[model samples]
Target chain A: MATLKQVAAHAEVSVQTVSNALNAPHRLRADTLERVNRSIELLNYRPNRNARSLRTSAVELIGYCVPNWPHQTHLVMDQFLHALCAAAERTGRHILLFTAPPGVDGMPTYDDLHARRMVDGFVLSQTETHDPRHGWLKDEGIPFVSFGRVWKESTQPGPWVDVDGATGSAIAVRHLYDTGRRRIAFLGWPKSSGLAEDRVAGWRTACKELGLPTNGMAVRCREDSIEEGALATARLLDSGRDLDGIVALSDVLALGALRELTARGIVPGRDVGVVGYDDSPLAEVVSPGLTSLRQPMDRIAEELITILTGDQQPAERLLLPELVIRGSSAPG
Target chain B: MATLKQVAAHAEVSVQTVSNALNAPHRLRADTLERVNRSIELLNYRPNRNARSLRTSAVELIGYCVPNWPHQTHLVMDQFLHALCAAAERTGRHILLFTAPPGVDGMPTYDDLHARRMVDGFVLSQTETHDPRHGWLKDEGIPFVSFGRVWKESTQPGPWVDVDGATGSAIAVRHLYDTGRRRIAFLGWPKSSGLAEDRVAGWRTACKELGLPTNGMAVRCREDSIEEGALATARLLDSGRDLDGIVALSDVLALGALRELTARGIVPGRDVGVVGYDDSPLAEVVSPGLTSLRQPMDRIAEELITILTGDQQPAERLLLPELVIRGSSAPG
Candidate 1:
């Protein structure tokens, strides 16, 4: 709270001298600069960056709307958020968080924040088909970037960075096949979800290409929960598909499969291989550590930041995920 | 990005009339106001609250310093942040997040944000004994509220809201006792942690009141991890302590204890009761769902907002956590 004049008086220097000591230290004698700095420390004076930002019209705050994903474990969003924060911090920016009101998908909050000029731009996540926010942001001419790609082609083009869920599923299938499990099944979400459909496509392509049986080897669930996953797994097992491997679209589903397998007294790694997506921390702690696909969250975050800040044309990036093999998918 | 003039031109009204339509609708005829509003919507004109705040000196932003706690599961922090965001939303404010540089406390960021007037006040978390940020904020005369109480008596009194960890642990003890467990043991953290110490005090108090033997019934770990927890549990079991019940300070630690018990063919809930804190989503997902203490994060968040925005004197509150019963501590 100390003023420049107070600091100058404390250091026995003119106000111009103190200002020079702070702004252009090379213009002042080394001793004078040191004295002014000492006075600043003594009085705990801090430079006002916000005032400078106001002049430059750069708040250095990125808006992020927290989505209410109806899932039991929010591990994916939590980790992605942390990575995004670290990415933003590296660029001397901070995240301004707000939630959409009930039954709305982030439009009102985004419009208010952008209109107020409280944020330089925004970083969007959980993009879906026909997302109204995309068209709205484009119409408003607000600078923004998304962590998930816009699924519909009719929407205006925008910068986005996303993980390739299809490739992730293929990689899991290949890992299971290489481990000598030819009968591979998939536990996936309903077809309405584009991302989950993409994952299922990868499973079918891989199964046919590898000369494996593909009929009745997949189960689709309506919700992404362990209970639903377990029920799906039960239907798969009861159908007598002779499946020896299962690749879940999410870690939660894989955990449910593991629970079902344990209850049935089936050794996971030895009798049937299991793999999960999104190598959540639970994957490592669970019994017979789950094999999972690890999304490049940090890289995706960095790319989103770059797209938001860069002065180039609109961009799109699809990054690959790494397959982390654990005991659940290990060859016995 | 539409200007007020553009909206006024489209509505065929003067700039003052447009402003009046937005600010004082009664001043204009209903038809005139409706015409102006339609023009505003068509042009997507939004009022500049940031510029207005310069005059009002109310930014409607509360600064929060994100701590880099080295833990695998961040469920507690994640849930608390969501609750805070929800609470802030109710009050028409938002949370601005910043991280402290490595090896330093939050003082530098707090000072910068406060000095710049980018934030009206701050919400502090993860407080420790002799935290320098507390003293610095007080010295700078900044309004702030803490989610954890300052431990040192010499530190200046400030508004804070915290969970009574001792009471949480006592509740866990009472639950275990009511389930017909007598020799209840505690899995805790190192003595240096004040919160963990409070939990230990509660366990001791409740055990002594119940006339249960307390000697050799506590296992202390250095970190809040499943590995450390399992090791502590192993030590307790190896020491012949006859502990039929275990109370862990965190869900991760209790999970490790569960793994240890399961490996030894000791069924949890049936033989050895187990309880964990911070009723994370994992508590319900894990097989034989974990019994844990659920902190009232929403209430705490509401209390924090009240303290930061209240017109009353600085007040401190310690809320009691609720015990959520589950299969992990069910009576067999």
Candidate 2:
């Protein structure tokens, strides 16, 4: 809390001299700079960067406002955040995490943070259709990049980096097909979510391309939780539709399907090839080692930071996810 | 980025009137305040909280510096951070996450962050013996509270909220014992970590209380990764030790142990009961649903924020971790 005046008094120098010693040592003599630094060290004086940045207009902090959903733990979001932090550090930037105030309107907090210069820009995640944040940031001319894309019809979506969910789902289905499974069922969330719709579209496209029946092969879950997945799979099974393979929209749902298979005395990889998306660490540690689609998290994060800080161009990137073969989707 | 002067000019008022409208609305007449507010909204002017805070000395941010270890993902830490963010919001505070610079001297970033008034205080996790952060924060007279405790021998440990790992281990051991497992072996990390040592101590204490052999029953792994855990378990099995139950220091290690057991044609719950720590989301989804100790993350994070923002007293809290029994450790 020691001010420049205190440091200056301690070093027997003027306030401007102390400031020069901290910011521009070239303007001061070596002896005077050293003396002022020694005084600063002694007094633990810390120059306020917020005040200084008003003139310099440089902020080393990147803001990420995470939605605080009380009931659910966003596992993929957690991994993305970890990767983003690591990527930011490699680029000599820091990520500042804050929870947006809850309610229908959270854009004001974003506006306030930017206006106060608490962050240089933001990394928006889990963007949805007609997302107010996208329009707001674009209108305000704030530097920001989203982890997911806005609606396709929107003319000004701004810069964004998103995983190719449809391609990921197609890859999962293709892997299951290559493993000699003809009947592939797609388990996914409701059609309201744009991301889920894209994934389902992938499944439908892959099934059509492979000449497999699409009707009665797709089922919807209320949520991506394990219990919902299990229930949805159970319902699919009870419908008596022949199913030899399953491609879940998420690893959570796939794990649930595996559990359901076990309860029915069905061998997972042998009787029914199962594939999950998002090759989280859990994918490898499970009993059958879930075959999953690995989103290029590192690349996505790197690209987001690159575009956000590099140029003002409105760029959009959709990175492909690679398929990871594990025990669950391998042929018996 | 519009300044107060622009709003004043637009509102046909003096700068003092604009300032009063923002900070002290009671000083202005109702009509004047309404007119100033309308002009402010029309111009999209935002007051800089950081500069205002320079005068008031009130900060609404809490700092949490995470280590970005690229090779190994800190799954429990991710969950803890989610819980921490939620808890902080209930108390009207935000968490700012930054990565500590690599190497032995990461304290400078912490010092700089505090000195620059970027954060009001910090919440330290995974504290170790002779942690420089402890001394640095205390020396600077900065506010901070640790999520885990420091070394017992330290004279001036600060406020901390930690789960009793020893009690958690004891609970796991007792559960295995009750399920008719006589010979129990512990799989733990190398003896450098105080938290791991506490867990091992609990295993030993439980063994003594149950009249089970403690000597030569504990084994150490190089790291907490699944591969290292499997290698350590294989080594333990190869040593010709009679082990019927295994208490792993972490779920990753325990899952690895299960894999090794399966490879050896040993059924997990029926033949050898396994218990892991930090019952992460992975615990329930894996085959046989790992029975592990669940740390009270919500309470720990809540207490940390409460203590950090409420008072400067060096308060310490130790909460008990509950054992979540699942199919992995069920009686045969």
Candidate 3:
């Protein structure tokens, strides 16, 4: 309840003397230390733990920054955070979450937090091709590991763990093809996103190998949201394309597609099969549970912590996603 | 990257002299201050923001503690966090997230963070009747606001913002009754949670007011997960209780009930009307979109931030929940 200033006033000493008495008693005179201790006991002052930790360099904190977008539902990222916390605990570390100030071109708050030593390192998520965090962190020689990777041409090798999106998408396409679905469509975000491009490329590769048409079957949205997915699916349906199967880049999109299909009197599993990425919990509850690709969130979290804590080498680790077959993609 | 110790070593002074030079130059000799500044510039030593803030007593950080339960999908909590972050930003404050050490009876980590002054205060979530956090924080005189409330009899209210769970349930029950449903079943968690009891009380009150039987329709589960919900629904159906309506305590349970009903060839809206709480985004995607109670998360967040930032009185504020009607509860 009492602050160091209050204790200092009560003891008739400088605030520094009171702080030193609590954190580094050897630096204070014996009489001064005794007087400070007496005042602390009288005022019931709880020594600020952060101040003591700062003096001794014992702040074992790791930070992760989430974008300040209120409308977005980060279901997969939430799961990843939960796993990351567990992994950090295993290493006797704690996680500190901060929001990325919106509209900032580069992460300035990250530099501030680093300079202040508020955290030992950061666990960067959603890394992009030209991510400014990569250059800033590397130049400052700050210890950090990303949940994603930089551009292929950047040649900036760093510690990262990401899901193999291409493999995940290819598995979805193969499953649909095996189920006798010929007219499969790919729904993804607009070009320039590395992850989305990887997913679309896998769909194209599968179509080429199986002699299925790829032209006019791929569509893009400005964002990865359920509303966008619904709008995209509506546009596809209105475009007069006869699609038998649909592979969505994310589960949110797949859910939107299912909603649109149901609104148009089309049963998802029977009339038009639907498969989604990121086997979120919602995937199971939907009628005719969605077939989806499950990212190894736990493994990714473990890998990130291992690299950040100096337990493993700094290398990019790409884990394969597992396809979970539900009723949504069952053969009619 | 240079620490205060490194700066002190380079300047031929003590660590306290380097700290004083950055934070309280008047307290140090002119020669000492000049030497420390020169060494700082030479070593490119950035003064730790946290340490400087500590000296000036200006750390505008509020903390929130999340449980480290991986098996639980905190869908509602995630939305609440997003809203809380936005609300905090409106007041020029930032949120710092920490995890409650698993298996620990009391929040020792919270005590440590507070002692170290890592945050100004905390925004506590999931306040239980016998919550250890309540006693510890209250005894320590820590400034915090709970997202939930303690038991009705405790009478030790400090600050809290919670939804009227009883009113939400009553609204659900009244809606079902008005829809000409007589046999309305209540599904909830096993006793011990005050919030859950409040919800079940609403159901009982509605049943008593309408002269309907309440003894055989109430059911309990060990957890609030979807799998448990499905098992409970299956058990209820197997009992042949002739229930025509259901009000689940949560959307997860309601979703599970829908899955079980569809599996048994019992249409939800046409045969057995279903209503869930917490109108999660997933509620709209499920077939026969679920009728649910929408908790005003944004308002709650706003109230919490207002209380935490000393802009409002420390009193309990209970917001009303809105009932969102959908196809799941439509009349046959």
TM-scores of all candidate predictions against the true structure: 0.74, 0.65, 0.63
List RMSD in Å for every model shown.
Answer: 17.5, 15.9, 13.0
Backbone clash pairs for candidate 3 read A48-B115, A49-B115, A49-B116, A50-B116
Candidate 1 lands at a TM-score of 0.74
Worst 10 residues of 3 chain B by lDDT: B50-59
> TM-score for chain A of every candidate model?
0.80, 0.80, 0.76
Q: Which candidate achieves the best DockQ against the true structure?
A: 1
In model 2, what are the clashing residue pairs, if there are any? none
The true-versus-predicted C-alpha distance at residue A40 of model 2, in Å, is 36
- Candidate 1 residue pairs in clash (backbone atoms < 3 Å): none
Highest TM-score model number: 1
Question: TM-score (0 to 1) of chain B, per candidate?
Answer: 0.80, 0.79, 0.78
Q: Is candidate 2 or candidate 3 better by DockQ?
A: 2
Name the candidate, 1 or 3, with the larger TM-score value: 1
